[model samples]
Structure formats: structure tokens, C-alpha cells
Target chain A: MSTASSTVLRGRVWKFGDWVSGDDGIVRFSELRNFADDHDPAELARHCFAGLVPNFAERVTPGDIVVAGRGFGIPSHPPAPMALRAAGIAAAVVESTDTAFIRRSLNAGLPVVTCPGITDAANEGDVLEVDLAAGRVTVNGTVFAVKPFAPAMLEVVDSGGLVPYLARYLAGNARA
Target chain B: MRQTVAQKIIARAAGTETVEVGDYVTVTPDYTVMQDIYFYKNIKILEKLGVHEIAYPDKVIAVLDHTPQAAHGSIYVDRNRESREFARRTGFDNFFDVGRAGLRHLIMVEQGFARPGLLVFSDEPNISSIGAVGALNVPISTEVIVSMVRDSNWVRVPASVRFELVGSLPPGVWVRDLVQAICHDYGGGDGLIQRCVEFGGPALSTLSLDSRQGLLAGMYHAGADTALADVDDVALAYVQERADGRPYEVFTADADAEYDEVRTWDLSALEPFVTAPPKHADVVPVSDVSGRRITQATIGSCASNRLDDLRAAAEVLRDHPVAPGVTMYITPGSPAVYSQAAREGLIELFTERGATVLSPGCTTCWGYLGALGDGDVTISTNQEHYPGRAGSRKADIYLSSPYVVAASAVAGEITDPRPLLAREGKPHVHS
Candidate 1:
């Protein structure tokens, strides 16, 4: 676990209704299997929100954010978060999400801030700034507290993902 | 420090003597059972993680239920192909593909992949569907499969909620009815979120293994993270009967275990409860919606559909035929249950009465197969009734016990099942 300076993420927000499932909402489950063997992350990225949002792949821009209701990115699918990162999204701030959704986002090296009432403060297309380490979010010119990443989880994300985290762990073990 | 059964199980898996509520422990699960729906991404993720050898090949249990018997050009086939190859390369010992089993949750317990007090991860929130045998199962994310292969994952010991069920289940009253009552008492789907619900009380011992499974499987309806049933002689004998001579251990909660909340109810107070659609706790008596037009009737799934369930359905359909226009699908929960149902002539009775026997799988209930047409009203013996859960958002699904499903199928609408089950000389005790 490392305690580094708090990182601030700035982006335009996109909102989804409650429980927009990880499989159907973030990306179609079929798209996951169709391009699975291709080993192409961009292929997954292009089809992100394929069924839920029309022209998602064409319209989505870098550093755009998603503000979802409870149970965001649920159903235990890994490719959902990876597709988010590959699409160049900055972060996702949710009212609540499943542990797996958060962990998958961490594995994808994506930041997810769980905050109550933050969704109400900002409308869709609102510009927001999320400070990771500080547990603060600025939307509608208002600041509110949000859940911060655990020191260890933050370190894992800093290393660029679980694969690099494991590599770092193995290297450290070898040195020790 | 009064520890609960949920805590004890986590303690053992975390390699600690004891643990308190909210303590996050790094745990290596005894068995990780993955269905085909979520395993495709896991395999690809493992490849990217540079996993040469699976960390616990012997501990992995992969079942092909969600996509069992893949059709031509189906996405399910793609998932099945990649997942099978990944299991082969990773050297996982137990991969139950199509024709072997339907639901991994039930198949895992039947094949001894899960037993008392062994940490189990089934990936979906419905993992507790196997808690009947005293196994603590977590419905986790796909990343968990990756962690189980590469290293381990952290588990925070959840505070246990005690459910004390007492009294006897009268005719037509099943665990499905009792579960709805529990959900209503605990706050519907919003209640057990993130909490560990522990079932107890005298009547628990009398509930059949299938009934216990139904009770456990109902945890997802209330949004429970996981669940545990106190191991009794009934659960023990059932485990031995299905364990294939494998060693199984039990963990008991301390006599004075602390509970965040305790709710008690008598089974005699329950009747044939039913859920209309969408939310599980959105329930009322079957008589409330009697004669509501139904186009489809299904009597099978991972949760409620079992041998006893099939028998209950057959009992109603034995003497009478299905409604003139309404069609019914009878799916056994597993190959073993399917065989038993066939041996008991339940399959014969169903087809003779205009019911179609489906292959054993989550098929229609999950909307992967047996999808209903638009605006079709269905009465099913399955758990989910959520919008678009049964493939079509326009179709309405009613969740009920097999007894109710059977009777309702005959009438082509929601009907009280009391008359169908009150017949004399009933030798069978439907779970």
C-alpha cells in the first residue's frame, strides 16, 4: 500500500438509471463473447454500451465520466470495466456499486468513487472534478465527501493493474 | 467473542482462529464454481494476467449451465468453446459441461464440490443457493475467479442476521412461500443487502434438502450477500447421500453468537405466497390474482425447480390436462433430478397432460432459452420476475411454488393450490 498525493480527475458526466447492469448496460454480453477470442481491447471499447446507448462508440470522448445509480457495473463481468478504460473514460462516480464492479475497475486501472448525493448535485453533461485521495467531489460548484480507495487498492491501481501489481509483488518477493 | 457460523467459516478459510464482524480477511476458497456465462472473460483475463498454471486447479468447479447445450451461431457456443479450452489448459479437475448438469449451484452440492463449512465462490449473488448443505457461498465478481487463479481475495466478515423459522409447513405451503414472508419481514430486496443471513429454529430440521436449497436460493431475492443454514441431521444425511463418500466437516455458531437483527415466524402462518412480477417482495396471496390470464407456465429453474418441485407440478397435472391454450415447460434442476423425475413417471404425467419436458437447465427461467413472447403472462416456479429477466420486457412472469405453478397451469391463471394438495393417501412429502 502506498500513500501518494491525491489525484484529481476532471470530466463531463454521463448518467444512467438504476441497476443498469454491467453486461447489458456497460457492454452487451454478446459483444464480450463475439470479440473475446480476438484479444482486442479496442474491439471491446468500440462496442461499449452498444445496446444501451445509440452511437456510444462514435460519440464517447476521452475523459468523459459516468454517474450511475446503485448496483452500477454489476453481474461480475470483467470486460465491462476494461472496455471503459480502453474507451478512455476518466472515472465513474456512483451512488453505490458491487464489490466486483469496483475491483474490476481497479483491475482495469480505472478510478471509481462511491458518493451519495453527488449524483443529485450534477446533471448529465455537467463538468465535475473528483479528487481520489482527498475523498472530495466538486459538481455544480459544490463539494461533497466521497469514499476514498484503500491505501493497498490505490497502490495496486497505481502500478497500472492487477497484472503489474502481481509482477511487482513477485519481484519484491524474489528480492526479499 | 461470540462467533457466528459465517464468521467461523471465514476464519478457517482466512487461516485465523477467530474473526469479528467487518474484519477483512484474505481468503482462498475451497472451491470456486464458475458457470459458462461469466467464465469466458475470466479465461481471457487469466491469459492477460500471465497465469501459466492455475493457482488452484483442483479447487475449481466449472459448470456449463447458463449456456448449456449451445445452439448454432449462438454467443453461448462461443463462451462454452473458450471456457472449455481454458479449463483444459488450466487443468481444472471438475468441469461439468452440458448433458452433465444444468445449474452449477445445485450440481456443485450434488457432486460433492461443496460441503459443510468449505468456502465456496459461485460468482453470482445467488451463490447461497447451495447453503442447504451448510456451505457458505459468495456471489462474487469475475475478478474473483482471476484472484483465485493468481493469488487470493479479501473477504470482510459480515454481521449475521438470525431468521428463526418455527412450526410445520401445511399442504401446498413450501419454502418459496416462507421465503417471501422472510423478505417482506426483512425489508424486501433492500433489507439483507451486504448482510449474512443465518437460518435457524426447530422446523429447519424437518425441511427437506430441496426445501433448504429453495430457502437459501431465496437469499438473492432479498439482496443478501451470502447465507448459512445451521447443519442438522437432515442436512448431514442429505450431504452424505450426495457427497460420493467425500469427507465433509461442519462449523457451528457459538451458543451465544451475536446477531445484528433477529426475526422469528411460524411456518403455520404461511400459505402459498406468490410474486406478481419484477420485485420479489412484491407479493400477495395466489387467490388475490386468481384467474389472471396466463399464456406460459414453467416448472423449473436453479432455485425453486427440484425433484419435489417436479412432483408437485406432476401431482396437479396427473389427473387433469393443462389449459386449452396455455403451454407449460417442465425442466428438472439437474441431470440427477431429471432422472429421478423420469423414474417417478413425473415426466410421463407432464407430457400426457400437454406439458412439454425441457432439458435440465436454467433455460427459460434465465431467458437464455425458452423465452416468452411479448405480452405473454406466465406463472413459473422460478425465482426471478424482474422486468426483461425472462427475455422479453413486455412479458409478465409470476413467481410461485411448483404446487401453485402446477395448479395454475391447469387453470391457465393464478389459482390457490390448496385443493390440489389436500388429497388423501399422500405418501410423498414434497420438499
Candidate 2:
């Protein structure tokens, strides 16, 4: 297992369909109800995709990617992406997703790329390579272009999420 | 370059002349709004970042809207208390305590914090409701903690999709129906994904600020990043009355502004619509599934629950009792809305008809109050009907207008409100 700060990632794909809700699909709203102030990633990870794919938490290995169809992660609940990261998912390649989902995913230390046809191009258990910097995905000898994250946002993902990025930012400002 | 309304607003906030789509710029929001549900979580994140002070205390606003009365239990009670202490510690005068609380989206506009051409960052997408007054609210989810600490955050300019609303809505065809129809048409695929939606054209003159807010708030169902309405006298008048000497700017789209897509919708052509359970965009006309029995009904949420919505519900519940075995909950959006509904006799009519009048907050819409039992079918004016949103996953929640919710409660089934409206004479459209 490797951190997401690496520019390129190789993972087995886990496929999902369109409109998989962040609340109900990725992580159930019920799982989020009882957290004591701070949401423990390990606890949330145990329930990640438990609603959609039973035993997903146990089966998913670190650096495995999530590929989905359009409108993935609707109603972008903040903890859904965090739960995915905690459950060892490295990156998400989707046909489309809302802006909030993109921001939340990056802030949770998970990188998401929007590729127009990634869902149909890849299958479950297929080994895929994602080039985060180049905004390209390769599967089965086929390549697809994806919308790349902006440099500033990429820096946040590279620093292992927004909290760490802001820590460094505030420290840099103080030093200056 | 001809810029869209959103571009102009962002440009002003970013201190730039203009911004093109896909351009990332750091901008200071006019207001950074927080709700109780995520307030403590944000503070925890801020502590992790080692930021002790809020960068812009004057621009920060916190509201105890989601669990104002701590409807759930002790956790919410504790969170609410801590939120108050944090606000006081930070010297934030904009905190709306329990009694003054409402849905943050509505309170921001009602209190004049969300004004034309100002940018707001919030935790939920429905905060786009501020667009009704020509303000843009970007939903940053948990990242609002970043904005609170820095007073600014980076935003990627999104392409705009323009919906030119034409013609007036027919009687009994509420703004919710029109919004659902638009969602049904444009929600599929990537038509509106991550895009800014702007509403304009001939019908803008007739739609009230409440209607416009209702319409904009539902754009999230269509996958819009955020939404805005063209500024007009109707919007300006409402803002001027509430702004209370606060300065604001009004931005309009250039005549030749570029849009990713231009769509025209005739409001009169819309019928009473319903977004069925499990999907916000799975919209169908009310007649398609009219006779399904309903055990619970509610008329509240950030999407609806304004004065006009309450009045609409009252018109349907007038002289009628909720059917046996049916429980209906009515939540006004804010204290002001509650007081006005009381003055207008809407609350009295609702209570006399056997419906529960909850405090002015998120209420059942948030799955906090009036949680449904297993196998309970519900008709509600709230947005989002994902499984288990209102308690039981076995329960089926249907989303519609206040009129439909009231009528369905009265009949104990999914019933159209047009017949009831006809029986009661012409329906009143409150602004």
C-alpha cells in the first residue's frame, strides 16, 4: 500500500453505477449518526460501501480504485470520501461527479478524476494505472483522458489532505 | 469577454476584472456560514490545523438550525452548547442561537447576510437558495473549516447553464413542480454536472423570491455546482427591505455571455410532479402514482417551508382534517416565517386540522423530528428522499410541493392538490 501523494497509482478496479449516493451508497447515513464529534476513519471505513456491496470493507485492499458512472457521489456527504480513504481505496475514476464531491474527496486525501467513459472501459478486478499528474488512465491497453485537478488543489491532495496542507501554509506564513 | 453572473461575482470577490471557466482563483467570501451539525467538526479540524483564530470574525456566521431544540438527544445538546461557547469565544456576533435559529440557507437571506453579488461558503448545497437574491453560495462541505481559518479559498470557475423560464405557472403548479420538471429533463447524464445554473427570461417577473429560492435550491438534484437567478426589481426590492443599510452589489450577465447550454422551459406546461424515493431526479407527475397510501406527510426543509409554502399548505388543509392514521408535520423555515404564518392563521388552520406544527427549523426534513416507522410511506415538501433519510430504509419518501403534501395527508394517499384548490376558489400566491 502506498500513499496518494505518489503521482501515479496502480490498482485493481471496483466498478459502480451512476448516482451512487455518498450517504447511502458509499457510507450509510446511519453509520454517521453516532460518531462522537471526531469521525474515526477506521470505524467509518468498516461501513464503507456496506450498503451497496456487503463485506466491501473486508474485501477491498489498499490502493484499489473505484470506477463509477455519471453523477457519482450525489449529495456529497463529507465523511463518505474519508471512509473510502480509510478503507484503503486510493483513487476514484468516474464519468462525472458534482464539484462538492471532488473537493471533499481531495480534502479526505483521496484523488478523484472525471473521465467521460472510464466506467465502461474498465471492469471489476482489472489492474489499472492512473497518472494523476498527466490526467490519463490506462486499462486493457486503452487510454482515456480525464479532467486534471488544478495545481493548488493537487498540492492539497499531495500533502495528504487539507488539514496538513493548511498546517504547512500557516507555518510558511508565520515564517515569512 | 462577456461574463456570466457567476463569473462577475467571483471576479469581484477575487479582485479581478474577469475569470474564464476552468480558471482557479482564491477569493474571500462575503460571508462564511456555519450550521450546528458541522460546527464542532469544523472547530476540531481547525484545531488540527493549529489555527487559533478565525481569519475574519466579522464575515463568520453560525446558526443552530439543524437541531435547535436538540430533537435527537444529548450529543446535539452538547454540540449546540459548545457552538455557542465557541461563537462567544471568537467574538462572533452573527451567531443565531436556538430561539433565533432557522434553516441556515433561509436565515442568511432573511437576515440580509446573503445579498446580491456576494459570495458565501457553506457546508450544504442547498445554500444555493441565496441565489434567489442574486448571491452565490458555494457548498464546500467540510472544507468550510479552511475558509474559516484563512478567510479565503480557491475556487475553479464552472461553466454556466442558462434556463430561460417562460410563461406563468398554472394554478396548483407550484415552484417545486417546475423545479422537479427541470430536474427530470436535465438531471440525467452530465448535462448539469459540476456546472453553475442561471435562471432568467420572461417568467422571472412573476416568480416570488420564495419561489426562486425553492427553484434554485433544487438545482443540486440536477447536479449543479451552484445556481443563481437574474437580478430584477422583485429581487432588489426584497433585498433592499432586509439589507438594513448593508452594502451589496448586483451583477448581471453580459448580453453575449457564453453558456454551456441554453434551455427554455414554459412553466405553464408543468404539472404537479413528484420525486420518488431513492432518487431525487426520478420525477413523475402526481397522477402517475396518485392512490398510494401515505402514513406520514411533512411540509418543511431548506427547499420549501417558507411563508408562501405554509400558505399553500394552509389553503389545502383549510376546513379539512388529516385522515385517520395519517400524521403530518408542518415546520416553518424561521422565526419570522413562524410569526407571519401565525398572523396569517396558517398555523391555526394546520393545528386544527390535526397536523403537528413543529418549531421553525429543519425538523422532519433532516430526519431529526417525526422519524418514520418501518413501512411508512411519506409525502413531503422536503428535498432529497434517499433511503433512510427520514428514519427507516423500508419507508418510501415521496417529494412534492406543500399543496400536494397537505392534500395527500388529508386523503391518506398521494392525491393531487389542483382539485382541492379548485374547490377552495382561486389559490393565493404569496410573495
Candidate 3:
């Protein structure tokens, strides 16, 4: 478990509409069946958003960020966010999302920021900068404030998700 | 400070006197449940974290409810076998394997694990059904591994929204309709996100335990963090009969407790409603799509597969055969429900009327049984009708009450259940 923190991410934006289903729009449920036992990041990345956006896997470059309207990741399964991270999505900024989805994304090592007016602030193909520590996003010279992760949650993401965080905790405790 | 039922429950679990909303606190849940579908994944995550010992074996339960019969394939069979072995190795005597298991939500309630004021950690949010008895369900999704390994989880105490339901539901209109009505009204915006919904008001006392469970189970579709209902005699009696000597505390909200919002709903004014295909927020009255043809019908899910729901379906299908070319499937929520339905001849009535009786598990609801073919249209009591949820992406699923699903099965179309119930003299009163 690598404890690498990319607090600041710069990427092109992939804007989506409201209520983009995490299962169908982010990653098709059928595609998840292929990697049920072994969730290979590269293999899962190949099918990200294959249903909604044709050749999305081929067109998308690493370090791209996903921006969407309200209720993003509704009816999301756990694997949906993992698929996004595996597909090299640096962060997700949305108008709003369920708390469960937010937690799931952070656990998958993807920072999900909830900004009230993100959909209207950013557009497709525009470059955006996300700062996790500062809790802000910059697009087109405009900055949008986002709800920052709690200090504990930031530590979890900094450690590359909860598993590694726990691993480090156990190791530190053992030394003591 | 006065605290709502949810706040009080969380405070109890945290071993604190009071916990305000938004306060992040570490809590030791009363119980933690694992189901078949995610059991392997959870174990894999635990292994990755290098944890071996069971933190609290007695407080842990493992059940093979999703694919109990291995309907999907040998993968489920392999997982179930591995789950059995894990249970034995961990000394988790609370494990419920196939034939002994049903939906984990209903199992938690029927076996008296979900007593009033207790906190439970589960994988799926719909396990909020246990809240019918005032128990709080905290769904951590795949993060349930955190609780399993550490025997504790961190939670941000959520604000509460109270639904004051008044008056009794009219004939042919069920709790499922009432839930859909709530979703239709408050599901669109972020009003319910990260908030706990509390069901109260005069109508709550009139509702049976099954009806209350159905209502709370569907609260997740409305984007609630979790839901709980006011516990009354109806809930307490049901728990008393099945509690198996478990000690429980009954907590009620203080009159001066704070809430994010409180809305009143008149049950008698509600009409039969259906969530149109694809979007749960696109709920409409049954009359909007009454005559649409349906190729399949199902009356089973964690939300609406209790005895009253079965009886409602049986009442509609009695003395009538399922329409030709229409396949109907009925699944009981738990083994206890199945046995009671069988004793009451509800199962026989359904089978005789050409409706298939599946095992007591999440069968059709989870897309394990009665999977739809391409272009098939189904009226179901399942929780979700999202695209590709049931089977082929080309197929469509409309969500409705058991009464509507059963009547639609009889007519091979989405038919309002009131007309059919009127023709049968009167609607049967649900217990």
C-alpha cells in the first residue's frame, strides 16, 4: 500500500448530466461481471463508461476529472468508483451526491468534491485544477469552493484508501 | 439536550450521553451483518488489511440470502461454500446458510436481532427495514470491512426529518404507494440527502409491522441516510414474540427534539402510484400508464415480500388464472413468512393461479429468478427498476405495490387494483 498523496490535481474535465447513474453511466453492470473476483485496475479501466460514451476508454486520458450535476452516482454500487479511479480519473466534482457515494469514492483513492454549482461552472474539454487540501477547484480562471474532506478522511485518502490506512495503523501500533 | 430517536440511538452506541447531528463519533454497533453477494469481497478486503481474528464473533452474522440457491451459477455455489467454511473457522454460530437463510433485513427482524434502539451495521441501505422496530441501520456499503476488522466504525450523526402520516390508507392503496409518494415529492432535490427520516404521526399506529417495514425499506430511494419509525405496541408485540430473551431498550424522540424538516402526509388521499421505468423520481399515478402491456409480474423484494404483501397478492389472484403469456413470480421474505403463507394456503393459491412460488430469498428482486428477456415489460414490487437491473437493458421494469403487480398479472397489463378489488366484493384488510 503506497502512501502517496496527490493533493493537487490538474486535468481536463469530462462533464456529464444530472443523476448520472454510477452503475449504468460510469460503468456498466455487465462489465463488472467480467472482473468479479479479480478487480484488475487496467482491465476494469478498459470498460469505464463504455455504455454511455462510445470509446470512452480509448478517448479518455489519464488524470482526467469527472464533473456532473446534482445527484451524481445515484444507485451506485461500490465498484463504480473503483472503476473510475482505475480509469485514471483524478477527482470527481459534483453539485451533490449521496454521502455513501462520497465515502466510497474516497475509499477507492478518488477525491470526490461536492460543490453547489459545479455543473454550470465547468464544461467539457476545459482544464481544471482541484486542490484537496484547500477544498477548491479552479476552472477557466474561476474558483469554486467545495466541502473539504474531514481531517481523518483526508488521512485515509492520503494513505491510498482505508485498507492502507488501517495497515499503517496496525503497523504503528505494533511498533509501540 | 433533547435528542431525536436517531441521535439517541447513536449516542447509546457511542457510549455517550448525547450526540448532536454532524458530530463524527466512533460507535460500537450492536450487530454487523454480511450477505452472500459481498461476503467474498469483504473477506478479500480483510485479508488485504492483514486481519485474521474475528473482532466480535457473537455480534457478527453471515447469511447466504442473495443467491441461496446459486441461481446465478457455480460462482455463488463456491462463495456459499467458502462462507460456510469461514463461519466455522471464525466460530460465528449466527451464520445462516442456504435453506436456513432469507433476506438479511427480514432475518434480522424475525430472529429478534433488530430490537428497538439497537444499532446495526450492514452493506445495503435497504436494511433500514429493521427500523420498523425502531432499530437503526447504518449502511457503510463495502466499508463494512472497517467495522468487521476494528469492531467499530465512525459515523457522522445525521439530521432527522419527520414524516407525519395521518389517516389510514384506502382500499387497494398500500404502503408501497405511500413510499413512492414520498419519493415523488422529496426525491428530486437534496432535501433528504445525508438526513435520517423518522416516520411518525397518528397513521403509524394503524399500520401493521409489515407495512411499517415496507415503508422504511423504500426510504433509501428517497435518498435518506437511513430511516426509523415510531415504535408502538404493534411493533413491540411482534418483537416480543420473536425476541428470544434478548434484552432491548426502547427509545423515543423528545417532544422538543430538533429536526431538519417535518412533512405531513394524508394516507387516505394517496392514490396507487408507480415509478416509471428508469428513474425512481419519475413516480406517477397508476392511471398514467394503466393500459400498458406487461410480460412479467413479481411480488417479492426486501421491501414488500412480507405475509401481508403475499396475502394482498393472493386476494387479487384468487379464482383467477394468470393471463396467458404473462409470468408471475412470488417470493416470501423469510422462511417464517413462507411457512406461515403455506399454512394459510396463500402459496397454494398463487401456485394454482399459475404464479410461480420461489424460495424464501431475494429471488426476482435481485434478478436471480424470472430474469426478463429483451423488450419484456414487467410490473414489480421490487425496490429498483433501473436499466439493466433485472436483466436485459432493453427490458423495462415498472415499480408498484403488490396489489397492482398481482392485478396486472391477471390482466397482462398495468391495471389499477381498485377496480379488481371492488369486483371481488371488498379489499382484504391487511394485518
Candidate 4:
């Protein structure tokens, strides 16, 4: 199977600590009411990392990478992830994860690389080169291995997301 | 690759021979229900994706149980209007409005939408409640809500974590106790992360059908993808009573089916347990924290709102009035459950004992319908206890079983329920 070696990427890193739970870490449950009626994705993106770093939105540049400690997205809500995608987050790098969190991330069209020690791989504002096909990351002149996406998963992601994948699928099926 | 029960169900739904762990499959759901919170959000997403029509309206069930009907706020009023409007627009057939159903998961089974060997989906993540009926229930993410609106959703097959039950519970020990023990043993829930946790072995025969639902409740936030039990006589009868002649399939794991790992639990040795504040995994023995003062007590959720749970609470409140300065709320899981309890005089008994018996709905647990003031301490029958989950981060919430909740409400403090059970000459039990 084709692995991370063929999938190369570059982005500046925005870092955080361990156990950034899906609930408060991504966004507070109380704040969900703000976006409950009609949500603006960019507005949500502005509140990114508000629970940890209040000034995070001001610092976040498009196409930046998010590196965080173990068990990122543990509460398993999707708003923060949706915010990341809307904010043009290139990918997510976390130490480890429960598979449900992985599913949640991918379903939201946010690529996540589960490489242990990812937290120590780079500091905030450092540009890191990630090779998804090779399961490797180069940060500050040092390189390390990260888990790669499966061929099937890469296909879904490359197609943009599950919605787009299904659009192509239903279209082709209708043609057939 | 070896298949788990969850994989088997998903493969069957997709019309495939087999699927391994991490293999993605798209299956049309047998049923899909959304809580009131997601009702408008799903419609909005579907519209954003340029889908003007729902593909399977009959397959969708609309549940308006969260955020009380006639609640005194704009959030509640707007959501209730959107819920009705969505059902009207999509022509969804299985709409469970406030008076009809109390919890989305219970209504799916009681109304016979989820049965043996079916694939069920809901937008609500706490859907471990649906797994009790010998079916696979996936509480999907928002992205899949688009797929569901378009008639399909992708799912990765989950590996199985088998939990074998042995022996029977002693007096005053309950199924919630066993669930708490599993959480504690797994280091507050790491062993079964993202895996299907299957309950089997001889001890199941000793439990009632509703108790099986309790077994799935604790597994939700602990990160078990799904919790299941084989279709025993109890499960079979429960389904038969509610299935209404709908076609259903019953399945068990193949003899050669592989598990990630299997652990056996002796329920006989288990004791009543109460979870500490702010997290489900911070559990302690009830005796360890006896007499801690409580300001509020709430019983009845998808976890423990059946007739059996009501009877247990009634038994506790029998001849014992609720403690002054401690407010208690008892909400049934469904109109059927509340109607049955009312027919049996349980509602009057609760009211007579100074317990505020609310009809079927979710309140005080989800933090929307009713909220506690700051510095308040509450003991509830809810499983999830993230900070601010109950409307106030300043308040402390302790998760316990319904029996313990009732006893504690009466005492105005967290007290072990064994003494109450012994006085009634009954053993510790669950629905």
C-alpha cells in the first residue's frame, strides 16, 4: 500500500499541551449556543484555542499546522475541527489518539497525523515538512516517524471529504 | 482479518461478506434519529450541501426530547419550531415529540425502529442507549449528517472488546456498579477505547432487559464505540414486545470470531459505587463518601428511566420523605414508561414523598432545561460529568445509579443505599 512517503506537506506549527479535550479544548459546550442557530465558520475559527490561548485566533495564519500533546479531540465533538478546516488549517499533528477521534477528524476533512513525540518535534512558529506517504516529519533539522494514512483514507481525503466523495459516487452510480 | 460483532453488523448492512477493523463501509441505516439540539443543524447542513430533499424520510426518526418543550427561553422556542418544521419538510414518519417520547435512544427501541441485527444511526453521540436491543448504533459526527441526509454514511469497522460476566450481584450491588468497576479497571476508560465492548456469559440471565441498557450507558463517554449483548431470552422478549411484527434478524458472534481481548467480571463481589465530581472515571465506593451533603438529586435518564428504575426509587421513597433544602427531580425516559409508572401509582408515591415527579423528558442532566446555581452539589444518575455539563461549572455533580440517587435525595447527602435495601429485605438490582 502507498504510505506517507508520497504525501509531502509544509506548514508553520501552532502548538498546545496534553489532553486538549474535544469539548473545552475545541470549544466550550455553552458557546455552542452561539453557533446553534446559524453558524459562520470563519467566526468560529476566530475563537479557535480560546479555551487555551485567548489570542490564538489573532496569531493563526492560514495553512498553519496544529501540533498538540496526547489524546487530542478526546471529547469527540466536531465544532473545533470544523473551525480548523474553515481557518485553512493544513493538518493536525498529535502524539496519539483514540480511533473515534481519528474518524471524527477525517470526517471533518482535517488531516491528522498520529506520530508519538509530535509535541516535541517542533516549537510554535517553526515550519515543519511532513511526508505522509513516508510516515516522517522534519522539524528544525530533525526528522521522526509518524503513522501514515491508509490508501483508502488518502483517497477520501484527496477527494476533499466524504461529502465530495459521495457526490462523485452518487453521480457515477446515476450514470451507470 | 478476524471480524468483531460490530464489523459483522456493518458488513451485513453494506451487503458484504466481511469487513476488518479500519475498513470503511457505507451502509444505508435501518433508522436515524436526531435529538432536538441537532434538528435544525442537520437541516442547515443539508441545505448548505445543496441537497433540497432527504433520500430516506421514513428511515429518519425525529426526537424532541432535549431542551424542554415550552421552555422559557428563545433557544428552546426556536429549536422546537425547527424540529417540527424539519419533520414537516422531510416527511419523516417516526417523529417523537415531547409528549410522545422522552429520550431518543429509548424511543428508537420502544417504538421498534432498532431491533436485532439492524444498523441504526443518530446524530447524538450518547447513543450507546441504542445498542441494548441487539443492534449496532453509530452516533455519527456532523460530516456524516450530510451523508445521512443523502442516504449513506461511511463507517470504519470497530474491533471488539469482549467482557464476560460471571456470578450474580449481591444484595445492594447494581449493574451501574459493574459498569463503574469496568471504567476503574480500565484506568477510567482506556482499555476499550474506540472498540466494541460486548457483554456475555451466564450472568446476563440474572438481569432484566432494562439493565442491559444500563450496561451500555456507561460505555458511551468512556470511548467504547458501541456496547452490545447477545440476544438472550430477556433481549428477545423485549424486542418481541416492541417490534410490532417488523422483520428482524438475530445474530451472535461466530465461534471463530476474534476479539481484541476478553475480560471476565464477577458481579457477586461488586459493591455499590458513586462517581466523584467532574468525570465519570473518578469513581469511589459509596461507603467511602457517605454523608457528603447534597443540594440536588436527579434520577431518570436514558441510563435508568424504565419502570424498574421507577419502582426502585418508589421503594426508596416509601415512608421516607425527601430531605428539606434538597430538591429532587424524577423524569421518566418515555411517555410509555411514565404512563406505566402512573398506572402503578409510582408517580403519586413520588409526589407524596416530596419528590418533584416530572413527566417524560431530559432535564437537569444536559444543562439546558434546568440549571443549578453556583456552589450547589448534586448527585445524579447521569454518566457524563464534564465540567459545566450540568449548567454550572461552579457546582459539583456526582454520577450514581437511580437507587442511590433516590436514597441520597431523601437523606440530603450522599449515603450508601445498602441500608435502605436491607430495610426493605431486597437485593441490590437494576432493570
Specify the highest-lDDT model's number. 2
Runs of candidate 1 exceeding 4 Å displacement: A1-101, A104-148, A159-176, B48-53, B75-91, B185-189, B241-248, B423-428
lDDT of each residue in B1-431, candidate 2, tens digit only: 78999999999999999998878789888898878777777776677766656778888887887777774545778777877888789787788997888888889998989899999988778889999999998888777777677777888888999999998888888999988987887777679887889999999879888888988998988788899998899889989999999999998899999999998999889889988877766899999989999999999998788888888888888878999999999999999999999998888889899999999877897588898778999999988788788788888999999888988999999999899889889655756
Summarize candidate 4's per-residue lDDT along B55-130 as a digit string, tens digits: 7777777677776666565666876777677676767656677677688877888888889888877665556666
- Please identify model 2 stretches exceeding 4 Å from their true place: A1-5, A34-37, A173-176, B71-73
For model 4 chain B, where is the 10-residue window of minimal lDDT?
A: B141-150
> Between which residue pairs do clashes occur in model 1?
B124-B139
Docking quality of model 1: it rates as: acceptable
Report the poorest 10 consecutive residues by lDDT, candidate 2 chain A.
A30-39
Query: How many pairs of residues collide in model 1?
Result: 1
Q: Give the CAPRI rating of model 2.
A: medium
Across B144-237, the per-residue lDDT of candidate 1 in tens digits comes to: 5554454456666778888888998887777888878776555342346567889989988888888788788877656577888888987887
- C-alpha lDDT values of all predictions: 0.75, 0.85, 0.84, 0.74
Report per-candidate DockQ: 0.24, 0.63, 0.49, 0.33
Name the 10 consecutive residues with the lowest summed lDDT in model 1 chain B.
B184-193
Best prediction by DockQ: 2
Clashes of each: 1, 0, 0, 10
Error of 1 at B74 (Å): 2.7
Over B373-422, each residue of candidate 3 has an lDDT whose tens digit, in order, gives 79999999999887788778888999999999999999999999998898
Q: How close is candidate 2 to the true structure, as a TM-score?
A: 0.96
Q: List the residue pairs that clash in candidate 2.
A: none
- Displacement of residue A158 (Cα, Å) in model 3 is 1.8
